[model samples]
Target: MAKPLNLLELIPKRIAKWEEVEGLVVILKPKFSHPWMREHLLPRLKKPYYRVKLDETGSSVWRLCDGQRTVEEIGKILSQNFGEKIEPLYERLSYFFQMLERNRFLNLTQKDQSSGQ
Candidate 1:
């Protein structure tokens, strides 16, 4: 039997590369799901990719998810920057990560047990 994952120990890695515009994070996702549609229809649209814009706090969180930091570490960073604004941080952070993962925005992987850090 496999053990359940510890939320704080999981590392969230961004699946799609994003860009920052006016201090906001913009996730550029391909509009078409099929390769044929993308090749044919994507060029016809005004924009090839769908831009998912994120708010200031969200942008900060998104930037911090670089595959290296665990959820706990991200929470600490958020606490330092947002302080009281991010009160009840862990619950909200967990929800945000869950939502992102469900939407295929990120991949949460288990931290390596062998690497002593």
Candidate 2:
């Protein structure tokens, strides 16, 4: 049986490529699921992909999830950058990550609980 995942040890990685638009993170979600459709039909539309604009904190989290940093490390960085404004940090981070995962925006890997990142 598999062990339960530790929130701190989970590493988040972005699945979709993103860009900075006016200092905010804008994720591009492909409109078509199949490659053939994307190639043959996507170009016909004015907008190729869905542009998901993230808020300041979400943008910061999105930028940090480069497949390297663990959730704990991200929380530490956010705490340092946002201070009290990000009170109740871990809970919010967990929710944010869950939502991202549910929406297929990012993927999470469970780091060994005994290992140090």
The candidate that achieves the highest TM-score relative to the unseen native structure: 1
lDDT of 2 by residue, 59-109 (tens): 999999999999999999999999999979999999999998987899999
Structure candidate 1, residue pairs in collision: none
- Candidate 1's C-alpha runs over 4 A off are none
Quantify all predictions' global Cα lDDT against the true fold: 0.91, 0.92
**Model 1 vs. true fold: TM:** 0.90
Q: Output the TM-score of candidate 2.
A: 0.88
> Residue-pair clashes per candidate, as listed?
0, 0
Number of backbone clashes in candidate 1: 0
Q: Judged by lDDT against the true structure, how good is candidate 1?
A: 0.91
Q: On a 0 to 100 scale, what is the lDDT of residue 18 in model 2?
A: 86
TM-scores of all candidate predictions against the true structure: 0.90, 0.88
What are the RMSDs of all candidates, in order?
Answer: 1.5, 2.2
Cα lDDT over the full model 2: 0.92
Q: Write the per-residue lDDT of candidate 1 for residues 7-113, one digit (tens) a residue.
A: 99999999985899999999888888799998899999998888999999899999999999999999999999999998899998899999889878899999887
